[model samples]
Target: MTTSLKLKDLSKKEMLLAPGHRMCQGCGAAIVVKMVLLAIDKPVVACSPTGCLEVTTCISDYTAWKIPWIHSAFENAAATMAGVETMYRALKKRGKISQDISFVVFAGDGGTYDIGLQSLSGAMERGHDMLYICYDNGAYMNTGTQRSGATPFGASTTTSPAGSSVPGKMQHRKDITRIMAAHNIPYVAQASPSHHLDLMRKIQKAMSISGPKFINILSPCHRGWRSKSDDAIALSRLAVNTCYWPLFEMDNGKTQLTHTPKEKLPLKDFLRPQGRFAHLFRPENEWIIEQSQTQIDADWNAMIGAGAGASGVIEE
Candidate 1:
């Protein structure tokens, strides 16, 4: 059963991720971190790989996290968190630790979709009791806006710049959520910061469930995406409304759609706000938008089919 939380239920929650950090304004990653931290009531040990969330939150001689936090390198957050969880199990078995703790890893697309996949896959395969989240901003935003495995097709980035000679990023973004689901983990979900209740409910659900859990969140980057800082949340909503970033979850290999748009918006509505896809509006590049729209529709339809075939309905 999916538990529902009212605004009053969360009013008294502790602020685990403190403010006054240097994360950019309207940063989706920042919003996701804070919300994820606040979603739980149990003690949590948080881990973050080297990226915007890390460098901006933890600086020399200070920190923004109120809970016990560890800063890992770009490729080791999953491994680090797994080790910690294992140690906790051992200690509890020995009667040295009595308190329950949730182990969580917060890594970016570069850390997760690219460098950290090995450790991540291993952790899930091992069936560790933890929740791993990837705040995907679609690029290696911390490293000069370079193209990453999560970068969108035809989007301009530092390494995949659009020009007359070539189109931006010759490939589509990798489907990490589907890849995680393939691991046969207990829980796998795709969420956005714009939908707070949905995201929170998923987190609460993960907290109750045992075994490995994963949440892939669409974290918009203003600098990398070349969008207005204040537009991050709205852009996130548009991404969901267009079905570009579908909200779904897979439980025990069953698929469920969390939020479906009543009238799915056009792909352009989601892409037009971000400068990364600006060149696609050119006469010569209009075909790219059409191609993207076609692909989005196909993917959405396939997801719906999967949801119907194997239901992940809350067992309330």
Candidate 2:
């Protein structure tokens, strides 16, 4: 599979997401979200949970969103989107609102994988025709870089600070794709900013599918991760190459990897770039790297097993 994706071919129109936003330099979430909105031209109603995206896009008296948007609490984006979907369907039945509108809920990893998991699960279990997108920055970036379920092993966060004995986050990152797939939804996929074209393609696929679709986007954060502003795309690419974040999709029923690295890079190549794992580079912090690699190996093995009967990894 080609790592060099044609992200701009999906839509040739001018950028819908304008400039002068409050997002920090090299913020991967901003670019990915922009491409997400650009993937579909139909009317859209978005339910956003409280997080960095919400805070930056919906500041007091300042709105950068071009589509119909609703600001909900941190843990209720799924529920809010459910209500909006219900209302839209009801209105369409009554000939009060058009049926062409698409409903999407955007939340952070903390909101989707932890606090909002119940509501999200409920919405998916109930089979709502909506898309739930989780921008996995790997921690609670808005309040603080606290250790969330999405935080990778050995990465340091506010809640998982390194100490004399404790290296960093002790737990492995949650397997969100598998968790969503277990819901038996129509679609579930993982994407990253490095593969913008593929990301947009999956967004369109999710929108067209009935029932529910869940997307876990690996959006790197410069502020929280202590990475360089210009290394966003490089970091994103390294994450996939290192198997720290795999790119794949679970279609109507079949699961397949979207991209398999030509050569798997070491976990250190992925972790050492960010200051979050800087402590892990110390002489005595070798255990952190070893544990991290073990976790990645386990995940890739499980993915291979689950997709054994399916076709080879999907090509662009």
Candidate 3:
């Protein structure tokens, strides 16, 4: 599955997700869906849990998805897709289904990290042939921007508000990609919309695999993060540059860093722009900023020790 898909080549492919859906301006999740769909050439069957993507794209008979799409509950997207894939396999064995249809589940971090973690684990453990994509926008952006398991530390949310009493969410975000990698699946990668080509290449690689594959994408939420609508891509890039989010993949039991910054930028470059971390920028909260930077540095060092560096290749 070696594909050098230029942007012009994507325009030539038919889009499975049509425009005019009710996604917010510059929604990273929407772009992820588009890019994923464009990367695959096979017939797709998409399953989405209860989240912004499901709600916005599917509204009572008027669907924006040109491909066959299913809207599942908040916690059963992976299970549902696994069931569908199982049935497809049965049909194919019985000579009823001829086409090689691919099954993909798109869920928010709330679904993947918290609500649907068990189901995702079950599907992966069962060795289901499917792709699970988690569009991680940090907090639960669909239902009032509440803090979820994926929300970063010192970030304000409705449930974890920044005020005189408390800082934002006190806990660090879950390393879901690592967790999934522990499943020993064939492919597990972390991606961001900022690097379109890298993301597309990972998606292609995931599609080429025959077993369970997972990709955790750091999708920025404009409304939830209190950032400009047009700044989603910029924020994503800063996330990579500051080493807040390092792009990597785990194959078998080995981990490899896919992209490493040439000259890593300061954590402030990524934190200062988003209002969620605005509280940390205060004079009194300088300690929080220091703590955050220390944590980032520690995580980056660990990732590099695990093999990410100038070459961006980590062989276990």
Candidate 4:
């Protein structure tokens, strides 16, 4: 079911997520949605949880989505999609529907990694034929920049503020991707809008599979991350280059590193640009930076070791 697509060829396709929606300038979630919709040629029924994407795209009676879309509760996007997919299967078996369709659910890190984790886990375990995508912007950006389970250690947020007393969020981000992989799903991957082609390819590959696929995309938040509006993609690129968010996928049970950095940059290169991490740059907070670097190095080494034969960028 995977389509053979090239970036150059995608320009001619009609856009599914239209412009003039209320998404902020340079919103990474919007970009991820556009790319995902473009990669799908079949009829799509999308379910979105209460988040920035849902609020902006479906304001009042006006909707920006060209396809059939549903706005679910704050913590049940996956559950709602599972019900729809189950009904679709029943109807198909009864010969009531003839056309092909795809089911996809979109949720923020707050919904995916925390509140909706039970619902998502249940659906995946039941082997639902649907795609669950987490557009993780680190924190709950739609709700006044509150910290979520996916917020990385030392990142400032309303709930986890940085000051002389405390240094931002004290816990590491939950590895939701690995958690999803543990279900033995057909497909699981982490992607970012910084690498458009790689994301498109991953989406295509995920869609080709039959049951329960998950893709967690690292979407940069302008307001929450205290980054420049235009720095979304740049920050994402820096994330990958620094091994802070290495691109990789798990097919069935085999893990693969998709786009490894040729020369892995220092973690500071990725963190120093964002105001949220500005406090960590102080001389007094040098230990926080060193600690973060140690964690990143450990993660990168573990990923490289796990994906032993996976293809990625090789040094010259």
The positional error of residue 105 in candidate 1, measured at the CA in angstroms, is 0.3
Q: What C-alpha lDDT do the candidate models reach, one value each?
A: 0.88, 0.84, 0.89, 0.90
Query: Which candidate, 3 or 4, has the higher TM-score?
Result: 4
lDDT of 1: 0.88
Give the lDDT ranking, best first: 4, 3, 1, 2
**What's the TM-score of every candidate structure?**
0.95, 0.93, 0.96, 0.97
Model 2: how large is the Cα RMSD against the reference? 3.1
Instruction: Please give the lDDT score for candidate 4.
Output: 0.90
Residues 39-134, candidate 4, lDDT per residue (tens digit)? Answer: 987889999999999999999988999999999998899999999999999999999999889999989999999999999999999999999999
Candidate that scores best on lDDT: 4
Worst 10 residues of 1 by lDDT: 307-316
Best by TM-score: 4
The order of the candidates by TM-score, greatest first, is 4, 3, 1, 2
* Residue range 223-249, candidate 1, lDDT tens digits: 999999898889999998999998888
Which regions in candidate 4 have their CA more than 4 angstroms from the true location?
Answer: 1-4, 312-316
The model with the greater lDDT, 1 or 3, is: 3
How well does model 2 score by local distance difference test? 0.84
Residues 223-268, model 3: lDDT tens digits: 9999999998899989988988888877676777788776799999
Candidate 2 backbone clash number: 0
